[model samples]
Every structure is written in C-alpha cells, then in structure tokens.
Target: MLRQSFTEQGKRVLKIEQQALIELEQFIDQHFDHACQLMFNCVGRIIVIGMGKSGHIGNKIAATLASTGSPAFFVHPGEASHGDLGMITRDDVVMCISNSGETNEVLSIIPVLKRIGAKMISLTGNPDSTMAKLADVHVCIKVSKEACPLGLAPTASTTATLVMGDAMAVALLEARGFTADDFALSHPGGSLGKRLLLCLRDVMHSDDATPIIDQTQSIKDALIEMSAKGLGMTAVVNQQRQLVGLFTDGDLRRILEQRVDIHSTPISQVMTRSCTTADADMLAAEALNIMEVKRINGLIIVDKHNTPIGALNMQDLLKAGVL
Candidate 1:
C-alpha cells in the first residue's frame, strides 16, 4: 500500500540520521574544543564559508551563532575566489564546510586566506583531505550511510552536518552566558522582543483617561464614567485614594434587569469588592495572562496604597503587541 511505503521511507530516514548522530559523537575530539576556543578568543567576527548544500547549512550555522552572541556571518566559497576574500582579516576566524574536504572552489582560496593570517577551522567528512589537513583545526562529520536508498542524494550526511553545526553553536552559546535578554536584543522585531521590551506603564492609560469614582458616588455616576472612557469598566475609590471596588458594564446590565434605581443606589452595594490590578513596572505579557484568567477586558494600575494610577483595556494590549 502507498501508506506502508511512505511510512517505511520515513522510518528509514530517522534510522539513518540517528546513526549519523551517533557517529558524529565519536568524531568530536581535541580539534573540536580548539575550534571553540579559537572562535571564543577571536576579537573580530567569524566568517563561515561553504559550497552547495554545505553552504545552506553553513548559512544557518552562521545565523545561529550571530544571534547567540558569537558574532558570525556566512560567505560563499565560490564568491571568495572572485575577490570576496578581502572580507577576511588577520584578527578574524574562518569556518569552512565541505563534505569531501576537497571542494575546488573552497580549496582554491585557502592559500590567499592563509596569507592574510586569518585562523581557519574546517568541517569535513574526510580528515585526510587537503582542506582538513591544512586547516589550523578540523572537525570531522562523517556519516556511515545516506538516508537515500540510492545512496547518491545528500540526506543523512547533510542532517549530520547541520546537527553538528547546531552542537557547536549551542556549546558556544552556553559558554558565552547568552541569556534571553541577549536573544531579544538580536530579534527586536519578534514576539520575544515585545514581551521583553514592553512594560505595563508603556501601554496603560494615564490622567483623565482612567475611569474613576468616589466610594459614595451613585451607580449612575460610575456608569456615566465607564461609558465616557469606553473601557467597559470603572474603578471605585475611597476618600484616602485607596481602591474600594470595580463597576463594569456587565454589572449594569444585570442590575438594569432588576429595575434598580441607578441614581439612588450606591456603587459600593453593586460593585465587585475584590478586583484584580497590575503594577506599572510589570511586563505587558504578564498583564495579558491576568486578563485571560480573569476573563476581563480592562485592568486598573495601582500603587502600594491601591490608588488607581493608570488603566488599560484589551485594545491597549493589542496595540502594544502583547496580544
């Protein structure tokens, strides 16, 4: 059946890659440590180079290293032969990737790169190959078999190479003490950036924008403030400027059905006595969680005395990239 054939192929790929990973573990030696040390000690950026499929993997490794505080970038080996070799300097480190360890385009530029006095680290399947043998440090990435049944396509070999690249990037990441804040700085346009960079005070409404009422105020006054602010809610405070209760549109609708006189009824009798509030210094992402669990659309920002300092609704969170 077609399903059986597809399943068998999937299993074969996993098996081949799993074995490749096991083989890669044995390939890690003193040279791997030296490569890490060379990269760590370098004052300048790391320039990664490769050809064909190796180039794609090299590009990803360079991006990972750069984002994790390693200061790296990728360059095509073919382009290096054309004059891009000027990008490398004596203070820099070059990481080269090649399956055969004898890529013509890469090997052709080695002499010029070396003459520039740049340190070299080579990743290859053949430790005896010229590229690996000539480099200052060599990392072996040999695989026993290709995931392709034809044994011609670059399957398990490429996966092994990418995994080894990830291992090197992650090891350096831990050694450098890279934190989430560091990652956020590198990805300022991402969700993690918004969560880290945005604060409660940044998205909250201040001054007259917040709906507030005195504890002795009638329910009608509270409802008028809530409607004018359009936050669907208002905070009730005492004479000491401390929060007392909250009044929402939901409470108004329920009380309306009872035919209660809003003008005569005190807000304290109908308002939610125990209300949730957030601090101005908290992250906006944390505010979103409180809104989700409390199933409310608005929150009042309060000080230590529980006095309403600011306010925000779900729309505020949306505008601030918290949602």
Candidate 2:
C-alpha cells in the first residue's frame, strides 16, 4: 500500500510539472524576443542576479549562455548591493531572476544598475509585479501550480524558469550563428572538446614511429615493422614513397590460413589492395567514423600526394581520449 501511494504521488507531481511547462510555452512571446535582442546587441557581459533557489537556476543559465557564445556570469543579489555591482558596465545587460519579482535584495540594487546604464531584463512569475514594472523588459515564467501538495515550495515554478532560461540561451545561440566548434572553444577540457578539436596529426604516430615498408619487401619484414611501431599495421609504399596498399595483422591471419609463406612471400601480394586511408588534417572523431564504417581497427594517414605520413589505430585513439 505504501509503495503504491509513493508511486501515485510521484506520478502526480510529474503531471503537474508537465502541465506547468505546457502553459509556460505561451509566455515565450514578444518579451522573450526583446530580451534576446538586448542580449545579442550588448557589447558587454550579461550579469545574472537572483536570490535563493532562483539564484541556483540563474547560475546554470549564466553558464549555459557563456558556453553558447554569449558572455555571461552570475552574481548574488545581495552581493550586488555590496559593491559587486561595480562589475556592471554601461553596455552590459542584467538578467534578474525572481519568481515573485519582489525579492528585497534584488530590488534594492536596481537603481544602481540603472545609473550604470546597464539594460535590465526581469524574469519573474508575476508580470505585474514591482520588478517587472521597473525593468525595461519582463519575461513571465509563471506556472499554474507548484508540484508541492501544500503549494508552498517552489517546484513547478523553478522548472518553468529553468526551461525558459534554456530557451533564451538556445535562441540567442542560433541568432549568433553559434556552432559546435564555437561551443567547443569554451569547453576545451573535457571529452566533448577532444572530439571536436583533436586532429589525426595530433594523435597519430608519425616519422620514424610510423610503420612503412616497401611493397616489394617480404611479409616477414612487414610484420617486423608493424611490431616495432606497435600499430598493428604497416603501410605498403612504392619507390616514390606513395602509399599503394596496407598490410595488417588481419591480412597475415588470412594468408596463414592459405598456408602462405610469410618469410618468402612479397608483402604486395598479400597486402590489402583496397584500404581505408585518412588525411592528417581530419578530426579524430571523423577518423573514428571512417574506422567504424569500414570495420577496420587501423588507418594510414597520407599526404595530398598520397605519400604515407602517419599511422594510427583504435588503441591510439582510445589512449588519446578520442574514443
């Protein structure tokens, strides 16, 4: 009986929050457009101010905005009054977040922000509230009801605010032509950055470390080169150093099944004539796609002239955090 009650209550909360979001969609009107325009046009940073729970959401919104090509940062409402308002510049935009639009701390610093000539954008649950009346633009984030049974806690309202912030950030991102590479610039320390910014030239084994052998060389010589480089593969090149084919451990296994002599057989005879190759300038993630599509574990990177320049395999990508 207790488990059923818990399940029912959990479902009820979700339904209420879902309804709140549906109604919240209507609030994305001209005011939202005006706010985005203000942010897009501003030459200075976006300073977000909120109190309590709203502050937490504002911080996340600030981060999202900053990462998406809009320069932004969060500041506590109380701290703004304590001289943090100095960060506000004439060209800046201040995004004030308060569900009731009546937070004392947030309201107290408005006149100073106005004196600084910074634009004001108020996100509040009450469109007719004091903060909304004083701001240059007002965005309503009101919800029909809080998910809390007693209707006291800020539940559905906070969710609505968060979604509204995301909408603004994404809208501005599109307006500014923000791209994946631009996003990666701000997030350069994680796996996502590596996938976007890492190139084959940065991770591939090059020069003496690259396994390259003449096509006329014996299969045993190819095996020695492959082992020495530990790339599981060797590039078969002609007299001009132009890549002609690839010799890999997989080819060796296939040849052994046919009772081919590794010591005497020419590598050109047993090498993979049709092989996948990549350019040194290609992104590591792009290389990963090629490897996956071709179902090959190793790749040879060549120059524009088709000369072998580097070699890499799945393991190298894994170690370089490209995988």
RMSD of each: 2.7, 1.3
TM-score on alpha carbons, each prediction: 0.87, 0.97
Model 1 over residues 1-323: C-alpha lDDT tens digits? 99999999899899989989998998777888899999989899899999999999999999989999899999998788878888889999999999999999899888988899999999998999999998999999999988989988888888988988888888899999999778889988977789876888998987899899998999989989988888889999999989999999888999999999999999999999998999999888888998999899889999988899999999999987778
Task: Give me the candidate number with maximum lDDT.
Answer: 2
* Model 2 Cα lDDT, one tens digit per residue, 203-233: 9999999999999999999999998999899
TM-score of 1: 0.87
Write down the lDDT of every candidate, Cα atoms only: 0.90, 0.94
Specify the highest-TM-score model's number: 2
Number of backbone-clashing residue pairs for each candidate, in the order shown: 0, 0
Error of 1 at 183 (Å): 1.3
